[model samples]
Target: MRDTQRTILVFGATGQQGGAVARALLRAQWAVRALVRDPAAPKSIALREAGVELVRGSFADIDVLRAAMKDAYGVFSVVPSSPSGAVTDEEEVRFGTAIADLASESGIAHLVYSSGASVGEKPTGVARFDTKARIEAHIRELPVTATIVRPVIFMEMLVRPGFGLDKGRFTFFLRPNQSMQLIAVDDIGKFVTAIFADKMRFSGETLKIASDTVTGRELETILTEAAGRPIAYARFPDEVLAANPYLRQLAASLDEGPLADHVDLNVMRELNPEILSFRSWLAGSGRKALDEALGTTGLGL
Candidate 1:
């Protein structure tokens, strides 16, 4: 007995996590409204065609956010961070906190903030990771029912170009024997939709989410099987880590365990029965991305 009239204001709807959330919410018969910078964009049009209401604005505009939040039952918030160089860490914190503040003021019943898995009780010394910690703290202080979802590294990221996919070899943050958790972007939507569906259960909860875990060696086997061609896998070389401060910090964080995902796969399976494993993703949603990655000459270490 869900209310079909209830609407969820979704940020980043044109992007991965938001798009998945929008689609999932729509499938569950919830009205979805998205804040987009351009209503004319093809993705925005697609969202509109998919029955999402598009509100044109940026996160910097509080008025736009307030307008979008008006009468909305819930909000799905996911803001992009650095390396995209779209916003500084400070700006990210500001935007995230502002969304929570406005949602609280607008009397929205639930606000789900999507954060990174590496974020925990303390700062990871990485700007992006620390930035989310600040926002999470601020959300807790607000007078709102908020659920924080810290999703692990995306399975989609692995198949993206520049991961050595084009060369039939893959280099990533994990060592051969070490394991890391990964989740499909689509499942992030599933998890969020479930959270919205059961506000009482997830309210005030911080859930670290991931569907599957794999080691570097396991990745090789999976990718080889998926590609029907041998695909090798290796950790990023020491020199590459030494030369790139960002990559080095990420690797160091993983080595120290904060960046390594510690998700309860069993609980996740219960919450999202349609959760995808690495092998299933490679065979399904990730197939096109993998094909494109393999065909591109990417800058890999």
Candidate 2:
């Protein structure tokens, strides 16, 4: 059981990953405090209603961050990255490192930093990933008990507009038989909650988390079954790859094995018994998003 008196300062609580962690922590009976840029935002208000203490501030608000950490038992740190144009890669490194530094200084018992699965000891030449690598390095050097969670690509990303779900076709970085690991966003919270529950076990550990691995063909079959219609799946055409350097680079990384076959599903299931598979997610929390992506009200799958 968690200590009821213990509070966790959660960054990015209004965002996807942070919101998942915050909700899971609260459900586990851990007091959660969130830092939000706008306390009046609907998400923030919802979080407050859910019993999370809200601290109004951005990542740049050091004074606010410090105040939020005071007397907190743990910290769950995640930051916006350059790809979203929310912050530059340099700013990402600074915010991540600053949070680690503050957690250490505040004598916070545990810190969990969310990073990308693509980030590793050597830079991947990807700004977003390399920025996290720098932060992980900084956290390791700090006098703090910290866990680094590198989550693979989120299942949510596959449903985004450009993925062609609406067109009854899907294009991605993988070939038909090639596989990539994916995690439901909610599973990230489950894993984090488990980690926090056993700080001694996870301390100083870098865990790569993913709920399921599927081939591109598997994605087509799943979507077809869910949508009640065929959805073709294919890798981005060579011409498309040639035109999009970013997409091409991501594909190259996958081929190089950095983003595939790294996670241990058995271990993930051990840590989070209820961890969601792609099919399970599509049937539950991901159902609505899938419907929206398909531009349908419901397929009744």
Candidate 3:
């Protein structure tokens, strides 16, 4: 938690979680060392311009990871989850465990891992995100002072095509009367910064991080207000889930429990002042994506 230490080595600096961590650390006046696959990439270049020591690296290469983390104060860890098809469940566990091992061996001070909301101390049946569960377990078994943050579904994902946003409707994992947790990605960084600043309280703690809960009915009202048009909300059709086994299983998991009405949003905004509700984010940071999702016609949600 000491800000005067070497630096915070951030993996996936080009992606959402790591980018948030890097920016927050910089604002806290901590030295930032970011690992990226291509430091020359525009985003990586931008990080460099912002005073981060961008190290060209990939998660698969341990030497690069080691080189980046050498003598660092802490490490912000997040795996590229498999929902995108770029990684398998097995690959995600491998990267997560490997990083924890490396962090332990290198004497990294504090390790904050970005895990998924669906993951808990006990196992859920979903393979797509349960990988985070496995990794969280692995981290706890290690000797490092680590904090695990399990984030709920992103509010930004609401507008994806598969959600039925393109058809003046919204279809999602939640039922019509159910409430589900959601968070803005920008809030992830601020929450993490606060965690890093007070390691004594947060160290070795597992957190289920979310900002708000919305029922399908509430989502309909909010989206309609934002778009200045009617946007009806409905649960995913049985046939649609039947056609897509992964989504069907995912929906079934939510129907079962844990996915809906799981976190306390009132306590969240108290912990972190930047927790933005869906309505506020739409009028603010989410405006561009809201516009695009409103106009989008096809592809995955």
Candidate 4:
């Protein structure tokens, strides 16, 4: 945690969660060594400017990971799931496990893994979420002190095109009365930094992280109030779910209760007091994007 000292090798440094973690670690004065595939990427350049050491590497390369971890205090690892279709579930587990194994074998002090919120004591039978389940189990057997963080659904996704930020209406996986928790991408770093700073409290533990919980109706009210328009929110229609198997399975997971009912929001807030509720996030980091998406080139339904 000291400046000009041990380094923390961060994977996915160019992406949202990784970017947040890298920035937070840099701010805390930790020497960050980012294992980026392309060190010349725009975000990678910005990271270099901020004092993060960029080491060109990919998850699939053992030598690359070894070089990155050669003299690191800890490693922040997160594999990209199916969001971009870059890797399948099997590939995700492979990369995640390989990273942990190499980090431990290299004598890294700590390994902080970022997993999805939906992963729990029991699998939800979804390959995407279950992939983390397998990786988490494997990390437990490693010889490194590790902290596993399970983050809730990202709030940024709600503001994207298909979510109705521009049309004054939105579709999501929530019944009018069912509650769901969400986390801001920025806060993920804050919590993670705090975790890295205090190893004794976080080590040997798996913590669930979330900022706010909302019912579908409550989300509608907040979005409406924030946009100064009547933004209605409702669950995706049955017909719509039937049209997309992925959407249908996701909706079913929530309805079955494990996805929504397992988290303790109060504990998360206690751990990271700076956690921003969904509404607060909307009015802050999301404001400019919302303005562009809704005010200028509106998102067409």
Compare the candidates by TM-score and give the number of the best one: 2
Taking all chains together, each candidate's TM-score versus the true structure is: 0.94, 0.96, 0.92, 0.92
Residue pairs with clashing backbones, model 2: none
Q: For model 3, how does the per-residue alpha-carbon lDDT over 53-126 read when each residue is reduced to its tens digit?
A: 98887789998888888889888898887877778889999999999999999998899999877664466667
Deviating ranges (above 4 Å) for candidate 2: 1-4, 298-301
Cα-based lDDT for every prediction: 0.90, 0.91, 0.82, 0.84
User: Tens digit of lDDT per residue, candidate 2, span 1-301?
Assistant: 5565699999989999999999999898999999999999999999999999999898999998999999999999999999888999899999999999999999999999999888866777768878999999999999999999999989999888788989999899889998889999999999999999999999999999999999999999998998789999989999999787667767876888468546789989999999898998999999888899998865554
Q: Model 4: runs farther than 4 Å from truth? A: 292-301
Task: Mark the regions of model 3 whose C-alpha exceeds 4 Å error after superposition.
Answer: 1-6, 296-301
- Higher lDDT: candidate 1 or 4? 1
Instruction: Tell me how many residue pairs clash in candidate 2.
Output: 0
Off by over 4 Å in 1: 1-4, 296-301
RMSD of 4: 2.5
**Per-candidate total of colliding backbone pairs:** 0, 0, 0, 0
* Residue pair clashes in candidate 3: none
